[model samples]
Target chain A: MANDSDGIDIDYVANLARIALTDQEKERFSGQLGDVLKYIEKLNTVDVSGVEPTAHAFPLENVWREDAAEPGFPVETALKNAPAVRRNMIAVPKVVE
Target chain B: MSDPLYYRTASALSRELEAKKISSLELVRAVIERTRAVDGTVGAFISFDEDDALARARASDARREGGEALGPLDGIPVGIKDILAVEGQPLTCASRMLGDFVSPYDATAIGKLKAAGAIPWGRLNMDEFAMGSSTENSSVKTTANPWNTDCIPGGSSGGSAACVAAGEAPLTLGSDTGGSIRQPAALCGVVGMKPTYGLVSRYGLVAFASSLDQVGPFAHTVEDAAILLQAVAGYDRRDSTSYKTDIPDYRAALQENRGPWKLGIPSEYFGEGLDPEVEKAVRAAIDFYRKEGCEIVEVSLPHTEYAVGVYYIIATAEASSNLARYDGIRYTHRSSEATDAIDLYFRSRAEGFGEEVKRRVILGTYVLSSGYYDAYYLKAQKVRTLIRGDFLKAYNQVDALLTPTTPAPAFRKGEKTDDPLRMYLSDIYTIGANLAGIPGISIPCGFSGDGLPIGLQILGRPYQEADLFAIARRFEEAHDYHAKHPGL
Candidate 1:
């Protein structure tokens, strides 16, 4: 219905994911992702209407630990690989003027 | 001393090291030298810090000298897949995105391994973010199949298997989401085992797919895999998904007699796209179990056909969320082409990821988008439950399920690179084990006409890894397949 790109638009999805694709990638991905989507259409045929979704293979209650803070990784170790570090803290581009 | 130390199993090396016939330093040096000599063509390693490895080895030797030995894995050289963090070492995940990202701490599995005195040797290669069936998707290196240089070693644990097969490392850890471990082990002609989903900790291991992703071992023999699994399998609070259950010594479990238990041969796995030779080999393995007094039953995992589809949707969806950490502000590759934060995210990711990764991320975003989330993601998850139910029902009759690890042996490099769908289908048989949270081991079953190896996958019920090890050991001890290493 509405200029079908296999039921979902690719360009908008890529934008949401924050990935910049070239014009060629956009076309290739549109066709390729369309094919994958079509293949997955086979799932609609299966009678899973009543079945519950299993987000994890093994479902367990969230584990909690003791309330004492152990000597964790040092600040230097944390900032060791920062692409932009100033004053032992990660420096990011300023958001507001 | 006749065979190189790198070729020897960690179990054997352990015995030798304990008996003082060889020191850890000597063993480490021998393996390092072997890796240096052969890794030029195998491309199994992305980084091998000789000084760091030696320092670890020397420390292990000092402990041993002081009569403070750890355990069976003491001083054994083990390769870590780059996805598993090693403190002070670059956690590349074989992607340019994290090329400069140094881990602040070791993975839970790595910590267990270090406590057991394993020398974490090098960062092995994998598919970028463990997305592809072949290591050709590696953003950093192209690891060749050690058996035949032209063909691919299966992936995304290709380098872990290849390095072991090439005698570059005795044992290595790999992560299997669909079939990254077992498939590569099959293609590279070795033993690889994926524990039940929560059997090992995932903390500090870069996430690909949270539910299906599991850390496992690649080894030359079942016993070696069991030993390595023993060291890493346990409860860790850091990984909430890790099962807090009694840990069994997998090596001790290997000695258990594989009895009159029924073995299931799933009819679906041997269906249409199955290779004749691989089917023959796997069927012969089934018959071999029968001859060894195990009952053979023709069981059905009816939803096996939908495993690949379900796996792609779920794995990519999880990956889309997991990989959102790599923005320009963090400890990874930054794009100099960006003028703003939003542009920074776009440019950094586009430049950082490889073709396959970008494709999956886009596909994932599409499925989880507004109108399609229920149609795709939720539908796939429900199908996943049906798939899991199939295994649970089949386990009602059989103790374990048998199938070919892959449809065919290793294909020549560049053969299936173009078609993403065709490549995804290579994981057909092995994907079901992961979806069900069942333990699966792929051992060297036979050789193809091309001299490539075939693997027989044995899938066991969840938390029955010890029994799986016992069954695998039974087959391994009876056959000479594990003894036949690839001639590199």
Candidate 2:
């Protein structure tokens, strides 16, 4: 993978994603990420001015299910995989004063 | 009959069950025993619940004895890629992020499978979070190609393909975000399909990239794949993306003899980086179609080279958004050392994610960030439209397109892991279909000189999976590649 000197700051990207990477990962991924980005440079040259961006493969519009309330997962089942639980609710570290 | 029963196709097993010559319990036992015998080397399953599977099989046998058989998939032993929830089963997605998590409910596909009396038995291995091209990225299991333990069964559906190929399971469900199912199926010498994006419901499939992610099946025969597809395809209220159109009888479609179909050969797919042997095998398959009186026309998808780049931008952007929920908040692994929420988010994600996953997240976040969004993500989406238009335009002239499922057969383990770009290119030939929101199937066409299996890919218009499957069975019925198995 070439450096390409894309001037991209990987640490900033990692920060936005809230992932703490070791210094080793930062150095290695910087070059690897650059190579991946360089490949996308081909997209910059394509004339896509009038093209409509297709977000879904299908052209269908919004589909709504019956609004009637239905049975949902049981409380215990909902909380089963929670890393921290307090009285059947997910426990999170205090965020605000 | 001791072990040969394990190697039979689901169709054959169903026949024996219908004839009352064998019970579902007997079939389950044979497959479980085979798993125990060979899975240590194959590493095809993340978890196998032998007791529960046998109980389910016993119930299926009870139903059949009462003359209440369900459907084609009844009494079948199937492996499920860990990405889909199967109620009370471990839903790890072969990742550490969801460590110890057990699904509380079955996914829509699993619900349909259960309704058809399919005994979903094992948690098949996959690339962690379905992120890599090889199953080596799985934190819990290192799945190997049953064809040769030294080589990879292409992934992130490696375990699903390997299990079917190794005779451990007659059928398995695998999710393809970008050729995950088809690539591995090609490498393992089986059949794998990716239905039109909206054709199969993705409800309960752990999202890697929502738009590209679809649940399909891996089987030893194309007809069996059709059976599995029929059992699972339809409208689902749970999935907004699932198409509401009437479901067609795929097996009946196979019998329709919609032959002499016009096929397109994409010249771009055969250029540089294609293995010479793979090229020969795929071309020979095309020649076979030509001999069947099917018109083969040379077609061009000029923007094919930009697919991987455009795919990464959009797929990673969606993945970045979807994965944000795993910030050690409600469900999943949390960092034990964190004293605050912010610290926990960073440390937990950093520790739980594998290398490839982290790289994708970072790349995705960067592309969608404030200034780069227009330069990357949005631009990629526009390019995506062009890519889709490319397929639509080419489809106006042909009923289907034929190409190699992969650039080559499965490579040796650890061969391209360090080179991320090199690994991403492993899916080069198959990503165009996903980007275009169409359906594609991979069938074993021939073998590489070294004895590894090669695959032929057939792609069709959206919701035209039946056409793709019809042609697949046509070519499949004419060859013995689908019948050959690895010497496991």
List the global CA lDDT of all models: 0.89, 0.91
- Over B75-186, each residue of candidate 2 has an lDDT whose tens digit, in order, gives 8888999999999999998889987999998999999999999999799999999998999899997988988899999999999999999999999999999999999999
Over B245-266, each residue of candidate 1 has an lDDT whose tens digit, in order, gives 9988777666655576789988
Which residue pairs collide, candidate 1?
Answer: none
Per-candidate RMSD, Å: 1.6, 1.8
**Candidate 2 chain B: minimum summed lDDT over ten consecutive residues — where?**
B1-10
* Alpha carbon deviation, residue B79, candidate 1 (Å): 0.7
CAPRI accuracy category, model 2: medium
The per-residue C-alpha lDDT of model 2 at residue B330 equals 83
Candidate 2 error regions (>4 Å): A1-5, B1-3
